[model samples]
Target: MDVSWVDGERRRVTRICDALRIRIEGVARAMTSDQSARTLSAESADVPDGAYSGDIEAVLITEEQIQQRIAELAESVAARYADAEDDLVLVGVLKGAIMFMTDFARALPIPSQMEFMAVSSYGSSTSTSGVVRILKDLDRDIAGRDVLIVEDIIDSGLTLSWLMKNLATRHPRSLQVCTLLRKPEAVRNIVEVADVGFDIPNDFVVGYGLDYAERYRDLPYIGRLRPAVYER
Candidate 1:
């Protein structure tokens, strides 16, 4: 029988696993006498409908885990900017990275200020067009200051690349990028990245500030969206 993991251990796992058409051969492995072992979910896995949908093949990173990484990133940033006579400007890409920005800035040992920007490439679909546009701009002057671009995801790096180029024209002392999730294949532009939290596959996730149709951002943990919900 095909076996799959349902994000639970005993009873709950059994419930979810039982609901699927596939038979259980093992835990998250062995597609049974049917198809090959599939991942937990899909790229546009994060969803906002039904009791249980958007359960894609996902590895959840907890708030505490994210906090730990932010701490490390803050330390690294603190050391680099320590020699500067001025305070650092943290520019967060809005919506997704806002929470991380707040926490990361709080973790910094140095004095700092924050600015917000909103840019999008996804339009109304699950995939990005690779062409990014600014929905909002920074309110503070970035000239001759140490700036850090905080982002939730670094996929199809076009947006970030454009951002770097645009920011450079203003002549910031230095512009560095810090992203929570970095996808190697999705980056289309070259930019100097400072610190990265996790390297993940190109899959959609909602929660911990990320969203699926602006839903699930309140979820404490990140998860792979279940496919059955979206495949329909």
Candidate 2:
């Protein structure tokens, strides 16, 4: 055999080996990236359900999770309403928004006042009637005051739309909305929300002031209700 030919053949083999090594390293790196992404997705999906005496299917947002987000939202709110002349007024829709109103109000850095308005749309059904009536109105006049409508969730956006229009007639200096949860798919009206803690899936969720037949509101975390619990 020619010695020079043998040397050339060995050089070609070495080149092939190096190329394979580089290809294998690329594959490994890609697999690692994919695995890391999957891990993060799984961790985000697996929120821990707290020890609550309710038929919750899965915890959507834990108490700690909500509080953390609320802190961030408070910072945003304070910045937005910092230069207001009068103390900011937080108008909470009754029953459902009570929990969120209290927690978020305490989180705010600026001084604010709180009021409640009881409006009824859902009597005992999961769906809205699109007809909102004021069960209870605000005691203090909102005229010339910066009003923030705090709500637990914005499902169809109809009730909030109606509320905003109704309050607009009261002649508030400014009106804005801040909600803990919002359903993107369920929004029928173009209600501008100042801050939203979470844009959740359009599912029946109960907990943290949201309820089914006025139950599960005391649960420390927000959770998706089991089908059997609500369907029946």
Candidate 3:
């Protein structure tokens, strides 16, 4: 006779416990999301003094953005040379292209050999002198190899143009250009790049292997230089 009431009581208790469990899980998930967000914000803000924060006008491309684009470039370039007989050759223009080259080579799925050429078109100035001089040449001959020119920035395109011509003499089987940044002037230089990570404005930029008077290259992200830093 009282069995119906006992069954009702048990069902009520089960429903209450289930609701509590769902509520607790929701609260826990929310707390975890908040903690993760705070951690990311702190990491983004913790730039070291070597980044030259004081001299940076604004961040042009963020660290995350650069790395993402480089990954994409690596995939595309690797696919292009997937059928190559030998390991693809990565011709890095030294000093500036060092950072991009290392990161890109590591990201590529296909094997690549790194060859550096230190060409100087700008000494301590913001403007390129339009004259290219090779400070260092490739260690091994690139003849009949698939060579990809990895560049940090193509500002006036003078250096890249000269580089293309110079590398042509080596008679590489296939040669192409992949640059992380390209300015408006570079578009008119007639040196077509196979892939460009970002086409930026004509503002003077530094960091991520690009520099001004050999400073600010240690920055993890690319940033526009404060006018005062270069003007002085």
Candidate 4:
């Protein structure tokens, strides 16, 4: 398990991080009067106020909220696993979840084990092709161990569903999922995600680890891809 394959993947991902489409304009500016997101109470249905491109049909979650939720999740995890040892294993879905794994590993409750796997139901295009494969396998030994699968986003749920079944054969003591984003609307695969950070609408999102044609991942914040550029 050289595991050096991750470095090249991250570099390739980094190069595609900056093409997010957020055009600054007078109308959109007027609507987004404030440059910063005003703190909203959890119960407040406060509308989003970031740079918008279209009907916002393309926008899903923002990086700010994701970080906030991640911290909260870490706190919750700390409280839950306080009495346990540092045997938590964090497995990240490749190509899309690499960025999330870095930030999430730092916020885990204890010193956890880390592993990466590349599985996808997506084609070269943005749409789901409904086929999943284990391109890369986990390097860590999960037999009789607690493993938490960290996913960037879960939609259609095909990949994770297949992964759950596949990993079950490994004899892990327990297996649970902690996804950064989950689109409940598109969930068809039969698997239970134990911990979820954010529940976003069913939209095609990019940035903060999501991509469109392999672009707009390092934008710091997630936003909808412009139809002209990605959705067509």
Candidate 5:
């Protein structure tokens, strides 16, 4: 066997192991949240029954809530970059960040250009490998432009950390991050986020372009996934 091929296989196995561990941890945490949600009385509960396709234990953030926050974030972003000499550019991470980027862009009062980059750390897995590969590059040069990165969620913070550093080499006038969700406990690296919509608990959530195995992106609201859904 070729030594290089054997090395590749070993790395593949390592990723699979890491993904499984993260999935198990997520399910355990979700189950706890599910139990807590059950304690809430029906009248006090916000999420109605049958609201999601999967076994959603609780609605973490509703669509109404997200929109309201997005409006506020837009105001802040617009004000900060209002006096900029150059046109603002919004860089959206592909697949996951599409929903947030579109909504955030529309909410901004200032004129801006949009660009996208597709990156992958975990192919079909639930966890980050701390290594990133740029599947697609930006179409336009960002040099001297004010760049804002719109993201759906910041989990471990590793991928975003890598991204910010990579983009810095392009010499943008300014670079900042605006993410819809962030998990403080799960952050392995310190990423300075300019605008954050929600600081949610460390739980595996799906909806609004975030998914588990590429499902549940169409959901309007964010919710904790039922442990059984992923365990299966």
Candidate 6:
């Protein structure tokens, strides 16, 4: 007998449910948007000058700056060897050049192969000893191949000069250099570099695969090591 009222009641309840569902959905969207904004802020936050346990005196180059330079270096190198017959061979100076080599390879527009050689002129010392030694040698012969020597940093140019002479014996079709960082001393020295990412000061820097006694290589950005850390 009251079926009409029941229908009205049902419609009212349905409307309430729809309204509640809409409100819930709106709250969820708002929460999601807020979370995304927070994530973006965290990612874009500026890295502090003394971010690395205060051991780094100052940041020489930020991570973003390093990456951008690397990309530009890669493009320049690729353009030079764009018409090469064989894939470019990247001869990375090991331990130090590992990071630059990998990143440069990935950024290169052309296909390339990798080889590493470990040469040392500075054995835990801040300055080069002026004597270069080969701690490791290339794994494969590079005869007749276009070779690019990837270096992390060149300070005095002793190690790079020695490496160039050594690699020259292999008779690569073409040999050139690409270094991520270089010092004023390196600039004065006569080693011809095909590409340089950044020409930094003569200060002792560690990070981005450059290190002082193997400590600061893991840092994302290049930084000057405090004199206290290595001077004593």
Q: Which candidate is the best by lDDT?
A: 3
lDDT values, one for every candidate: 0.67, 0.77, 0.78, 0.65, 0.76, 0.76
Please list the residue runs of candidate 1 whose C-alpha ends up more than 4 Å from where it truly belongs after superposition: 1-59, 187-189, 229-232
Error of 6 at 94 (Å): 1.2
TM per candidate: 0.72, 0.77, 0.78, 0.71, 0.77, 0.77
- Of the two candidates 1 and 6, the one with more favorable TM-score, higher being better, is 6
- Model 2 RMSD to the real structure? 22.4
Clashes of 2: 0
Across 55-113, the per-residue lDDT of candidate 4 in tens digits comes to 23433456677788787776765565666655688888887888888888888768787
Give residue 69's error in model 2 in angstroms.
0.6
**Candidate 3, overall lDDT?**
0.78
Model 6: lDDT equals 0.76
lDDT of 2 by residue, 79-184 (tens): 9899999999999998999999999999999999999999987755688878889999999998779888999998987788678767766667777778888876
Error of 5 at 96 (Å): 1.0
Output the lDDT of residue 213, model 5.
83
Task: State, as a TM-score between 0 and 1, how close model 3 is to the true structure.
Answer: 0.78
lDDT of 6 by residue, 149-183 (tens): 89998888888877876676566776777888877
TM-score quality measure for candidate 6: 0.77
* Candidate 5 Cα misplacement greater than 4 A, ranges: 1-51, 186-188
Ten contiguous residues with the weakest lDDT in model 2: 33-42
RMSD of 4: 15.5
Q: What C-alpha lDDT, on a 0 to 100 scale, does residue 154 get in candidate 3?
A: 88
Worst-scoring 10-residue span by lDDT in model 5: 35-44
